[model samples]
Target chain A: MRPRLFTPGPTQIPERVRVAMSNPMMHHRGSEFKEILAGVIDDLHYFFQTEGDVFVLTSSGTGAMEACVVNLLSRDEKVLTVSGGKFGERWGELCVAYGANTHIHNVPWGDAVNPDDIKKFLRENSDTRAVFITHSETSTGVASDVETIAGIVHNNSDALLVVDSITSAGVLPFKMDEWGIDVAVTGSQKGLMAPPGLSVVAMSQRAWERVGSSNMPKFYFDFKKEKVALAKTATAWTPGITLLMGLRESLSMIRAEGLENMWANYARLAHATRQGALALGLELFAHSPSDSLTAIKVPESIDGIKFVNRMREKYGITVAGGQAQLKGRIFRIAHMGYYDALDMVAMASAVELTLRDFNWNFEPGAGVRAVQRIFMEDE
Target chain B: MRPRLFTPGPTQIPERVRVAMSNPMMHHRGSEFKEILAGVIDDLHYFFQTEGDVFVLTSSGTGAMEACVVNLLSRDEKVLTVSGGKFGERWGELCVAYGANTHIHNVPWGDAVNPDDIKKFLRENSDTRAVFITHSETSTGVASDVETIAGIVHNNSDALLVVDSITSAGVLPFKMDEWGIDVAVTGSQKGLMAPPGLSVVAMSQRAWERVGSSNMPKFYFDFKKEKVALAKTATAWTPGITLLMGLRESLSMIRAEGLENMWANYARLAHATRQGALALGLELFAHSPSDSLTAIKVPESIDGIKFVNRMREKYGITVAGGQAQLKGRIFRIAHMGYYDALDMVAMASAVELTLRDFNWNFEPGAGVRAVQRIFMEDE
Candidate 1:
């Protein structure tokens, strides 16, 4: 059986998109590729909801995050990073790595950062250069209030609001320009329904001004060089050509299905996944969950690792177990990209079967029934 | 008609590899992907010909080049960079970007750096932390004597010999361990017969020691994190999953054909290309040409850009024009990865057609005849 991917990132790709990428490889610098790149950039503006330019990079989401850190802030500059989960903590770590005077505002795991806390921090430290936060923390399946935080940062201080929107951008209704976000970064493998290796960065005009004055050392991920090349419909260096080709198709698919519809679809899937887990007598992990993935607390009676492994090894359903401190305590069911109501139903069925194998207290069809009810009601 | 890729990078993908990647996208963190990663790493050892650890980075060749610099040298550390072409000049540019005290030894555009010069430079600058050079200068089509330079660095100084083997690794007969090289970085698109987006690095024991002590800032391209993750047959971050899948097939093809056989095939193709260009009354561009690609000086009568454009526009063949200072003065036909003698013949025929279009004086069928003769005689 073909494996079903329920992991947060590296989500399943649609067959149409896969077929599009199988066409003969083309020269990245040629006119044909430039046209495709231009189209991809246009569609990216739609998804990002930004009037400013978006740069496509050749590395993972972390690379884009690093690019933003280097481009916006100089060493010894003070920045505030919200640390709620693994991804949120990465922002703080990146700031630390660059020798930025960083203040990490740690939120409880499985909980979203409070917007008021950010306002208070910014008010207390008026000299903050930027604020780094994650829109959707994939590790804990939490979605922070980025819209509110953007307003807080804008009102409270002159700090630029940078958002790690890797798991949120297209999956959520994010308006980069309307919300006044300075920098937003995302990866292709998540909401774009494409392969990994390409990361897109949408920088506001405000962010671009800081890029020139920033004293951070950079070469491969230099934003100004990328900007110059983008103006000419080219890249500063050799891009991830195949991934860009695939992204052209994936972004087309996203456009065909309006961004609002895609966001609503993920929301329905997230709701169904949460209801399904609850029907299986599993507790939901996140206080404010992201629509991209649903994390469920592993019961004391069951072994989380074996449950995740059996779902993959036996049923060809790959779900991710929790990472870092949450290891062996939770399993995540991702609903981002190329997923439908039926896929969620299938995921629910797989969970039901696995729960039975682990001798947990759950009805045979309870999880699937709950998931079907949610989908049926939505329709 | 299907367009043919003759540019140095974003090379044509093999049918088998494309088909392999077209399969359902697998979860990168799953056991299935781990197995694929293990197999890929194993085959990488064969191609790199190294007992030391090799890293697979998810960016273009330039990213791996930056990784080596950041990992090996701290700020203000002394380094010598050999600049012969656009790519060779990039080594010095990256060093300068990272605040390294770099002395770039400028060689004439088409000429390779002399090994004796490197020996003398190392003797004069005994405190040099690293020596950077390019094995194959893609822009100028020149190949430096890295083997001889390796001996010079080993005998003369305690400096690490870093080589950009992006175009040379699989196309040329290179033995990393036997040659006693310190750090060699290559890309997947050129010599590995794969689509772009991935780069590989082979670091010797001596290079690894410098990585930890070096105080340069790094996060996404951290060699230590990648090395630790590689021991478990995984990447430190999300890798280019689809590209890696394609590379697994490409590497298998390389192994089945044998590394030495692959090198010989590229050599034969390069030889045929060179002879064909000479038969067209075109002068060779490089003094010490790399087998990966052949650079020919564009006749003053023909517009180099127009010639390259016509080859792609009418004949569906894409060859590269010269970069930087040689722009509009030279054209390059690449023989690297996934090219055969017949492909070289086709390239020659396309060159003849375009040369005729430009009204250049060259005998009809002479170029084709020369390429055919080389192939026929080699057989």
Candidate 2:
């Protein structure tokens, strides 16, 4: 049997989506493809809850983040970056790479940034061009309160509120237009339930205004160029046709479920998974956890590496371990896209068996029972 | 029935490769993924026929072309760009975007650059950092003499011979090591017989030497960072997992056929296709033609768009019309990767029927019979 994926991003793709990828590729410039483009674009805007223009890129999510920097900010431009975890830190790294004088607000890992810190920074730096925030910090399973932060930025100054919603766009409740976010970036592989390849970015009229004044060297990821092509239901370069076809199918699945119900389901899965882990005497890592995934602190006596390996090799279930500083201390089990209560229970059961085999201080079926009870009560 | 693609890229993905894409995506950092990455990288080296490192990028071929520019050249560095087609022109655009002072040598739209002109240009520009060339210009169906050009550039100056072999790598005879090319860039959808998503680039030691000194501003496409990750059998960012699995299957098919036999097969098919088109009183557009695909001048009486549309709508075969300035003047039919003699004959028959249906000048079955005769002669 194939191992099930429980990583934060690159989660398990639904069979329907994978089957859509099997459709034979066609010319990107053909009318048939343009029709697909028009439908997919409309569906993306509906999913993003934004009336603004969203552009598809043949790149990873980081490329979209880089596009946000190069297309909206100039050299030595002042931007405030919120770095709570790895994805958040990437915003700062890209800013530095582009020669932006960025002020990074460092929130400790495993914690969400307080909205007030952003307000205070905006007050001190009224000339900031943008406020870069990660909606979901996958490394720590913490989602920042982007709604409040967007409000704070828009109220304080003319700074654009740019959010990296790669892991949160479809899994969480994010309304770009209602929340007044100027730019929202994401990828196809995460909550969108498609294979990796295409990155998506939606920009408000306010952000487009900044693009006209911005002078950053870019060719492949020029947002203005992509926007022009999208206007004609075309792409500036060859589109990632196969991934886009899969995305249309995945978006159809998302729309059928309705975004609100999907978000609610993720919340239940996270709750059940966390409840199962806690029932086995494991501690939760994040104070303000995200529904996309749940992070748990490993018991001191158990090797986190060996524990994850056992879950994979012994039971054919894959979970992600903590990165960088928390490598040996925390492990993350995601129930993001294409996952349900039974998938969560299977992971929990594997965890229970692996920990029991290691002689950890836990009941053998404690986690599995907790997961099952949570699902039954929810039903 | 779905339309068959004969465009330069986003070509028809084979059934086995499509089946491979159906495998559930695994985590990028998992043990299973690392194993896959190691194997893919090894096979890519063999396919490229180079001892140097090849990096798997999750973007299109243009992204890999941009990587060669940003990673190997700093601001205001002198580089000679040979532009004949759209993809070839992209190298200059990227260099100019990155502040490189490029001297573009324009080869007329359908012809290849002469080796002597490059030799003379290198003599004039002794301080040139790189010589950008295209192995197969898909837009014009012109295959540049990259092997000869690489020799001229190496013998004259310290310039790195960068070749955009997007359509030629798998369809034609290309030896990265033997030809002394410094950088070779390609996409998966063309001759590799996989879906669009992953772009492959191999860099020689000579090009890596310049990377350390290059000061181009880049983050997502930093080649040095990708190399470090590849050393550990990993990627710097999340990879296109499903596409890579599909690529492994495609590469196995390519190797089983043997690169030399594959190249010969493409040559024969191209000859048959050109012979078929010529038999219909069609004029070949490119003087120096490519085996990957063929370009032919459209009849003055026929509408290029309608002609292509008729082939697709009536016969379920898709051919490409010209881009930019040549939109109504020419059409392209590809015989690259996974196409056999019968496939070529089917396309030729469609062209004959579509042209006849449009009441343009063509004899019935002349094109099909010519293609059959060529294939039989080869046998």
DockQ, candidate no. 2: 0.79
Among incorrect, acceptable, medium and high, the docking class of model 1 is high
Find the 10 residues in a row with the least total lDDT in model 1 chain A. Answer: A16-25
Q: Per-residue lDDT of A32-68 in model 2, one digit per residue for the tens? A: 8898889899999988999999899988899999999
Most lDDT-accurate candidate: 1
Give the top-scoring candidate (DockQ).
1
Worst 10 residues of 1 chain B by lDDT: B20-29
Candidate 1 stretches with Cα past 4 Å from truth are none
The whole-model lDDT of each prediction reads 0.92, 0.89
Off by over 4 Å in 2: none
- Compose the digit string of candidate 2's lDDT tens values, residues B1-379: 6567888787777899888888778888877778888888888898899999999998889988988999999999999999898877888888899999999999899998899999999999899999999999988999988888988999999999998989999898999999999999999889898887789999898889999999999998999889999988988777888888889888988888889998999999999999998999999999999999999999988888888888888899988899877798899988776788899998888888888898977679999999999988976
Docking quality tier of candidate 2?
medium
